[model samples]
Target chain A: MAKPLILVSNDDGITAPGIRTLVEVAKKIGEVVVVAPDGPQSGMGHAITIGNTLRLDRSIAFDDLDIVAYECSGTPADCVKLAKHHVLKDRKPDLVVSGINHGSNSSISVLYSGTMSAAIEAAIEGLPSIGFSLCDYGHEADFSHTREFVEQIIRQALQHRIPENTSLNVNIPKKSSEPIKGIKICRQAHAKWQEEFDERLDPRNRKYYWMTGNFVNFDKGEDTDEWALVNNYVSIVPCQYDMTAHHAIAMLNEGWEF
Target chain B: MAKPLILVSNDDGITAPGIRTLVEVAKKIGEVVVVAPDGPQSGMGHAITIGNTLRLDRSIAFDDLDIVAYECSGTPADCVKLAKHHVLKDRKPDLVVSGINHGSNSSISVLYSGTMSAAIEAAIEGLPSIGFSLCDYGHEADFSHTREFVEQIIRQALQHRIPENTSLNVNIPKKSSEPIKGIKICRQAHAKWQEEFDERLDPRNRKYYWMTGNFVNFDKGEDTDEWALVNNYVSIVPCQYDMTAHHAIAMLNEGWEF
Candidate 1:
């Protein structure tokens, strides 16, 4: 049988340590093709390059490892679209893996995450996909500790089909002194960013604002991603791109008159 | 009793005619404040400006009408965040309304929609929000016919609470000789874009690609937004920011092992 083709991408640029690590793991699973953003695009969400043109350039990120890679001049979602429709146009990959991101996309953050956006784009294309992230945000955050679990999760996803029209959001807790706990299947927690803008003066002494925010979790349910992270467990959330609030349809049908 | 306060925004920039029509209609309901992008920000999903400095300037778009408005140098989601945190600092608005967009945001288009992203941002912040779009992509498309339905939906939303953590994705069909049928409360259809990148040579003779796609609907269900739009009825889909596929949790727990 031919090896399963795996398309790997990330928001942290093609050469980031995170994707390098993700590539290392993905190679063990199948034939790996890396196509990712040329620069960091952390909070890009599901943005696409519509008004602007896109550039897809060959990169030597995995030259030593003898893998095919490309650096795309667009957002994460753009990267996936370009890969599927241009670079890998004739052949669809068996699976798509995004990230091993520097920071978490555990709950409400998922809505603003470029990492998860890539996975969601693949899911929208009817491909099985997974986005992996670390809870650490530092530039040189330790990723070695996540290797075992990351491999395990990817293996399972490739072996068993993810639920139809769904992608997996896997967030690993930062390396800790205690041995890592097992994985937990969880839901996205009810949480949000309490936004704050730091009002400041630029070099010209003109007013400009820098966005900052605090993450506040309102859901106390144990089956949530937040709970799993706090308990040092790897959290896997099956995410779907269908934004429809199915439960609310009945409410609107009954109460709203037009 | 005080009239409900409505925070209005759009992805087509502050001066666009679509928003003017929206502001004209929104004012009939309550006190209005507008904060939107200074330039077009189409396809900018749930992105927030983090690494970049943001500029917010007072705009005279609604000056004659006596409504407070500001133009922000950011994405649509950034407009909502800036409004909630900086512009409208002390007082929270009763509701958030985005668009009256120049283009459609039905079915799978919602994922890449800056218009819907603003409403989803408001939903994440626990506000009752609605994103209104006309199924016409032209800049001068007639939105006059949509006003009555828009007013009715907003009135219903303000009178009765939206389901918790949910926003409304409302799309009105373009003007026709036949009047629009009543609004239909619908779900996001199972659909996706069949992407095609129009590769071309730049002035520098470098190969560049323009991203384009055709919308393909796999779902033929009558209860979907696509069906409602084709029938000339306004489609109202309740959208949620939580990406969790709750039904798949049990399946993941049983099928995949750590």
Candidate 2:
């Protein structure tokens, strides 16, 4: 049987250590094809390159490794679209894996994460996908410990197909003395980034604001992604593109007169 | 009793007709404050400006009007954040309304919509919010017909109060001979953009691609946003920022090995 074709992508550029690690793990599972942004796109969310042209350049950075790679001059979501519609046109990928990101995309951060956006784009295109992120944000953050769990999850996904129109957001806790706890299937925590802009004056004497924020978890539920990460467990939250709050529909119908 | 305070914002920049219309409607309901992108930010879904400086310039465009407005050099989500954290600091808005957008954000388009992003941002901040869009995509699209319906929905939202953490994604059909047949509360239609990149050569002799797509609806259900719009009924989908596929969690837990 032919090897399963896997498309790998990330928010932290094509040359980042995170994507390189993800590619290595993906190569072991299938014929890996890497299509990612040319630069870091950490907080890009689901942005696509509209009113702008896109450039898809074949990069040789992954030449030493046994994988086909391309660097795209667009967001993480754009790379996935370009790969599916242009690069891998004739063949459909069996699964799409994104990240092994430099920072955590757990809880509400998923809404602003480029890593998960790439994975969600693939899922929107009817392909099974997963996005992985580490709790560490440093550029040289160690990712060796996440290899086993990443491989296992991908293997399990392939063996037992992921649900339709859904993508998994897997966030691993940073390495600690206590051996990393097992993976936990969880829901997204009700959390948010409390904004605190650092107001500054530029050289031109113009007032500019640099956004800084604190991640505040409001939910105390044990089955949440935040709880899993805090307990040193890998959290896997199954995310869907359907933004409809189905439960609220009934309430609105009852309360709203118009 | 004091008038309700309403925050108005959009993706199509501050000067666009869509936002101007939205502002007009909002003014009738409350003491209005507008903070929106300085330039068109279409397709910027849930994106926030990070690793960069943001500029919020007080605009005099709406000086003759009763509302105070500012044009910020950021995305739709950024506008709402700036309004909530910086501009409107000490006071909490009674409601947040985004758009009268120049295009439809029904179905899957919601994922790529900056208009909806502003509303979703407000929802994330625990505010009752609604994003309004017209099915027309032209810059000079006629939004006059939607004015009555838009005002009605906003009044209803304020009176009834939307469910917690839930925002309404309301899309009105373009002007027709027949009046709109009331509002339909529906779920998001399962639809997607079938991409077709128009490949072309740049002046620098480099190959560039223009991303374009066709909207394809896979859902046949009548209780969907697409169906309501097609029938000339205003569609109001209760949108939430929680992307968790709660139903799929049990399946993954049963099938996958940790």
> Using DockQ as the measure, which candidate wins?
1
**Per-residue lDDT tens digits of candidate 1, residues B1-258?**
998899999999999988988899899999999999999999998888988999999999899899999999999999999998888888888989999899899999999999999999988877789999999998669888988988888888898879988999999999989999799999999988898999899999988889888889999899999999999999999999888999999999899877
lDDT of 2 by residue, B1-258 (tens): 999999999999998999889888888888999999999999998899998899998998688895799999999999999999999999999999999799999999898999999999999988889999999998768899999999999999999999899899999999989999999999999999989778899899888899999999999999999999999999999998889999999999998887
Off by over 4 Å in 1: none
Query: Which CAPRI level is candidate 2?
Result: high
Clashing pairs in 1: none
TM-score for candidate 1, residues paired by index = 0.99
Once model 2 is optimally superposed onto the true structure by TM-score, how far is the C-alpha of residue B179 displaced, in angstroms?
A: 1.6
